[model samples]
Target: MDSDRIAEIIIAEIRSTVPELEAQPITRADSMADLGVDSIERSEVILATLEAIGLKVPMVQLHGPRNIGELADLLHAKSKA
Candidate 1:
């Protein structure tokens, strides 16, 4: 999938996982913490996003993504792979 679509998916997952985030505009530069996503919420976001994209990225691999844009990029690369 394309990066923009991947981003949309990630954002949607975030909103679903953390309802408070639904009211705020998320940006590529915004870290999970910046958006009030705690550690547990972060994990939920990661798992949900991976599931949504139909990918099995290791949890360790997910550590590299600092924000939505980077996560989208990683998901895009993995989808292509």
Candidate 2:
């Protein structure tokens, strides 16, 4: 899927986990800080997203995309490539 669709899914996941958050688009470069997601939360997100995508990405690969938008972009690119 494209960025917008991917973003919606990511946002939903984040909202489900972080209920206190105001929903935002994961379609673009929204920072991790903007989502109120700290490192611990990101770890959970990493596992969940990987499982959803059916990919076993190395943790190092994930490290670069330190936010939902970046993560989504990375996943999309990886799938496309």
Find the candidate with the highest lDDT and give its number: 1
Worst 10 contiguous positions by lDDT, candidate 1: 57-66
lDDT of 2 by residue, 2-45 (tens): 75666666776666667777555453567666667877776776
Tell me the spans in candidate 1 whose CA falls farther than 4 Å from its real position.
none
TM-score against truth, every candidate: 0.91, 0.73
Itemize residue pairs with steric clashes in candidate 1.
none
Error of 2 at 68 (Å): 2.9
Clashes of 2: 0
In angstroms, the error of model 2 at 58 is: 1.3
> What tens digits encode model 1's per-residue C-alpha lDDT throughout 1-81?
799898988888889999977889887778888888899988998898888888986788768787889988988888888
Model 1 deviation from native, Cα RMSD in Å = 1.1
Candidate 1 displacement at residue 14 in angstroms? 0.8
